[model samples]
Target: MKIISEKCKKCLVCIDACPVKAISKKGEEVTINGDICLECGCCASSCPNNAIEYE
Candidate 1:
């Protein structure tokens, strides 16, 4: 999965939706830890801004 930073609103919606807790936030920056990500597309689906994309 990938995060389109331009499209991200930093809402952290995807973080709540991530089952693996792979998403994290620092200040206004949100990121997905690839090593912990399950790639289940849960984050992608939950992104209201369509910031997360899955392969």
Candidate 2:
């Protein structure tokens, strides 16, 4: 599974890249709901800042 790190810039790109819609934004913070995530790696691949990582 992957998680968003402190390096995130709130671009919200990962949210859109996630095929399972597991990535979410609450205020300025973006998060990935592991239970709903498909672990397809799309969010990590689309993250321009390399904020998403395997944990």
Candidate 3:
């Protein structure tokens, strides 16, 4: 799944939840490349800050 940056707090919740380690930090933003995302909702649901969401 892809994430909406506006809703993201850069909390890193999605970063830790990704089993494939696809999440990454870019400056103050948490970014996930769709190519490596695997379409798993794990990161989205794990985000306590609601930083990640489905595309």
Candidate 4:
């Protein structure tokens, strides 16, 4: 899953929605740590702005 910065509103919902705790905020950018990500699309679903893309 990748976060689209243009679409992201910094809601921080994806951070809490991640089951593996892979999502984090850094310097105003909400990012998903690929190392801990499960690719379950949890963060993608939680994003109201459609900023998270899971491929």
Candidate 4, TM-score vs. the true structure? Answer: 0.94
Worst 10-residue lDDT window for candidate 2 reads 1-10
Off by over 4 Å in 2: none
Better of 1 and 3 by TM-score: 1
lDDT against the true structure, per candidate, is 0.88, 0.83, 0.80, 0.91
Please give, for residues 1-55, the per-residue lDDT of candidate 1 as tens digits: 8888899999888889989899999767788899999889999888998888874
1-55 in candidate 3: lDDT tens per residue? Answer: 7677788777787778899988999888778877777887899889876766677
Candidate 4: segments with Cα more than 4 A from true spot:
none
Which number leads on lDDT? 4
Question: lDDT order of candidates, best first?
Answer: 4, 1, 2, 3
Q: List the residue pairs that clash in candidate 3.
A: none
Write one digit per residue (lDDT tens) for candidate 4, span 1-55: 8999999999999999998899889998998899989999988888999999975
Error of 1 at 47 (Å): 0.7
Q: For model 1, which pairs clash?
A: none
- Give the higher-TM-score candidate: 2 or 4: 4
Clashing residue pairs, backbone N/CA/C < 3 A, model 2? none
